[model samples]
Target chain A: MAANISEETLKVSYEQLSDLEKEFEENEVEIIRHQVALNKPLYEKREKILSELPGFWPLVLEQAPPDVDQYIQPSDSAVLLSSLKNLTVSHFEIDNGGKGDPRSIAIRLEFNENEYFEDAVLEKKLWHRRAKSGWTGLVSEPVPIRWKKPGKDLTQGLLDLVVKVWEEDKKRGPGAAPITKAKDYTPAQKELKKKIETVSMGGVSFFGWFGFRGFPISEEESRAATAKDRENRRLRAEGKAVPDDEDDEEDEDEDEDDDPYGLEIFPDGDELAIAISEDLWPSAIKYFTSAQETGDMSDIDFEDGMDEDDEDEEEEEEEAKGGKEPPAKKRKA
Target chain B: MAANISEETLKVSYEQLSDLEKEFEENEVEIIRHQVALNKPLYEKREKILSELPGFWPLVLEQAPPDVDQYIQPSDSAVLLSSLKNLTVSHFEIDNGGKGDPRSIAIRLEFNENEYFEDAVLEKKLWHRRAKSGWTGLVSEPVPIRWKKPGKDLTQGLLDLVVKVWEEDKKRGPGAAPITKAKDYTPAQKELKKKIETVSMGGVSFFGWFGFRGFPISEEESRAATAKDRENRRLRAEGKAVPDDEDDEEDEDEDEDDDPYGLEIFPDGDELAIAISEDLWPSAIKYFTSAQETGDMSDIDFEDGMDEDDEDEEEEEEEAKGGKEPPAKKRKA
Candidate 1:
């Protein structure tokens, strides 16, 4: 029955739906603004309560939703538990007088003095902005983490490589943006390939997320998106529709394949950031309380049915192989 | 450090946070109301466009999000694709003067003449009602399907059993509600165990969803929730805090185990309903267009790398063992 339907008819209807969707989106933004204002005092109270309870953030992070939790390796978990003092996610653009996106947020992770890193604080700010291609989303840049020793680098130098790549790419003349094709920088691509392999569990370190700068799209891909925007406007003006070019989409996918560094390292960075800011941050008390109920960080179990004691033993075994254990546990011993 | 903090302090802070969360929720309802009004015309337009495109809803269902898609077995898919003509989800209580819950919805599925059932339309209305426990969510009742033959029952008699159980339970005294423990009805529990084992793929049929009433909570469970509500109010009056009874919660979980029929059959029914109504229904055109791009129902692949031709072959093999294929494909062949 779909075979009998003309492409032009479907396109016209699809465009109409798209117009409706835009209206829905604009209305949703208004709701978000109201929520941001209403949640201010609640968030402030949450901050106070969390501070009163030590080791709260660590417990919350241990039971982080699966999306964000997957990025945190066992070594990363050890580091976070030992030093993570507090966590706060703020809608930084909330009070920007409608000039900024309300959804744009800053995630701050404060740490006590630790053996692993020299820095007392690490923060990643995501700005909700639109691209030249007419797509709007949260975009971020790499934040440097000052590891006391190379051996203590939780991201296994992946973050360093990303920083180096961005700096070098920026040095390239105009039009050579940070999120360009990896093939343009063959030397960095060779290094990235080696670094990615060293990462385990089909995911990068939680620390590596600090380097996320959003997904890359080539000039060709951007132009295609722009063309679609033009076509949609033209269809509205002409009061008719034509079949969309599927070939262009296929080519865009092929171009995406050329740049795998940022995508591979933090493919769902924006989503993960949103998840953390919107869900994990506000619900810290709930998550922390649940984690407390278990009497063990059972929610963090990636492997099948591993007990806390078993995990502790495994951590020791991992330490023998040059990994680190939570120093607080060692201090208790 | 948590060991040093008084339980009273934590409890007081948690209650304060809960109060704030309630405010956030009330604000959210306002947003949802605005969206419902703004979307009225858009949904009407969507209905018109969807009617023009044949097999559109089938294709959209074929590409449904994992949450909803998981419930649809291959046999169920064959039935839906063959007969499903139109699907609509409406916020039925939206226009009702503020007394009615705006979130209450009705999901309507229309079908063409088919050999499976006598009914041309199967509609399930889920009312957003508050339970005796003060918990509010979508509550529904079984909408019976008149199967033409015993062999043609897509739910394989689960719906029939559920209906019988509900009817029998309703006949009991006022205290013995529908969601009570399965132990109350020994004969039904025995039959349910038998029917449950026969259901494949750790899920029930798409047709079985017609019988989804919501998660079960016994009278004992309701009293516990009400008691907590009472305690919170008392605490507010007294301006003091007390630790919540973890023992009570443990007992609630134990009681839930005694009533496994509804929970086992549709553990996430409320969540699934929300996903369908909010995401799938509004995004039908997008899902359908993407399905058209593949030209095959690759999104519905349960087994690894199974092509359309392979699926058809498997269907034929299954049919030889007493099943049916989508008659449209059969006619084409």
Candidate 2:
């Protein structure tokens, strides 16, 4: 007979089990809660920065004309100048063309008081171009700018400082308060604005100018261009608007009537008799045969009599439906 | 005087420039085509495989009875039979127990003959259980069958072979074709059919006996059971179920609420508490307070008195708006 367990003993065992289970469940819940707590602040901070940056754009734009506006009013330029009035003036310089007229132009620029020495120096150089015009004006060159630190505020400070420097140079130059209508810009300012416009339009890498070029064209675009060129040539041959260039005359010599191989073009100008490089023919054959098997003949145009084997297979299939067996296979000699 | 260059020499240089440009463009187009050729086969293979796998489900389901469609089926005592047909046989066996004679049952199952060895073995075992009813009748544990090596036409070969095996087994056993009505089923045929259904339902695992014990109880059922237990206890305490046993009860401890932690019993008599560990509280509080100061309060429930500081700050802001200067240096001593 089984021994009877005491109620107190049973209760103690039950309490221990209950405690273990409770602890396990609480740990699970706490772990999830702790992970959420750890991640929530980071997620919120990222979201806040993203939202605030876009909001800051409007404030930045308030100090300058809209980028898309073709004409920048002198009043808009004045507003831009006023925004930078409290910035510290780093230096005052007048560019005297070596031709000996010191008073020919005098321009003064105030750098942001909080800007670093290197940034202030760069801003001073950038401002010097704002005083010239026409062929004699300075041309804009891509210069690398390094930040003093990594935070969003520091990056924004640098951008604001650059804009302030440009504003000061514009405001202090020449005859009128509204500088846009002043009828003349130092050739340098005009060139700088044009370069800025190009950068904004192309979004090309600055490194591209120094042997990097632009991002390579995508494969899809290249293929599309080739296909379009092929189609244009075809349409022109059929009397379309495509111009008759020398290449069109060359293409006519390579049209093949019964070429089993699917070469798009032949250098020898005789598609049927032209020999492919030994290395290329195997790949050509594989492509053609696979395409034929898959019924994807759009890439290759076969002559009527060239695909006799396909026709024979179709005829045999029809005969089989009529209760006739296909012909015996031919034996190889 | 500077010498004038000949038109022929200039034309030759111009032609060479045009040729170089044309060659560069052609090379770019060729590179694009080669890339497309490389990727095309992989895409085609992926597409082909994706289109083929979805067709296997219906074939798998065909071996089971069309109507026996529960993810889990329940039987008396929760003893799940290996197959739907076996369940039917068990039901018949239970129903016929009171009768003088055991009833004869026939089961038929169809399955893919070319499946792996484990699958065929499982199928055969499940079907055999219908006829055997208990563990004493089989020769050995069934092994899943697979197609022969170089598996061409193996599906048809296995189907024919299984039918032959069933016929031979029937011929060797007496009265194996047990039917009240006139019918023929060799013991092996009945066994094979049951196995097929089993294999279809459980695959190669053959773990039908455990029968999904870990499945969660439904919330509704749990709630109902708790309510029922509470009512029954209440009635018993009031001397409704048994009057004599009531006086035999020891002093009922109504001091249950005296436990300081307020632990509660769930319907299943499982206890839960929301108490924090005394050892961890100091560290938790320090971590939480530091997180709050750093704008990273992801853990604490600052839902009640914690917001009082924020309200006080708002009041100070309102006073400041009304031209009162904020107090400086209110650091705690």
TM-score of 1: 0.75
Instruction: Give the alpha carbon lDDT tens digit for every residue of B34-138 in model 2.
Output: 323343343343324322322112212221111111222222112122221111011122223342111112112223333222232222111111111101111
The candidates' DockQ values read 0.18, 0.01
What are the chain B TM-scores of all models?
0.74, 0.16
lDDT of 2 at A308: 37
Model 2, residue A318: C-alpha shift (Å): 42
Each prediction's Cα RMSD? 10.2, 40.1
lDDT of 1 by residue, A1-333 (tens): 223457777776766666655555555666667667766776776677666676677777765655457667787887787778888877777765554567678999898888888889899988765344355566677888888899988888888877877676667754654444655545875686567776744567788889887644443554565466656766774877666766546545656445433334565566678668766775665556555554544565433375445544555444332222122101101
Judge candidate 2 at residue B263 and give its lDDT: 11
> Model-by-model lDDT, in order?
0.64, 0.26
* C-alpha DockQ for predicted model 1: 0.18
lDDT of 1 at B151: 97
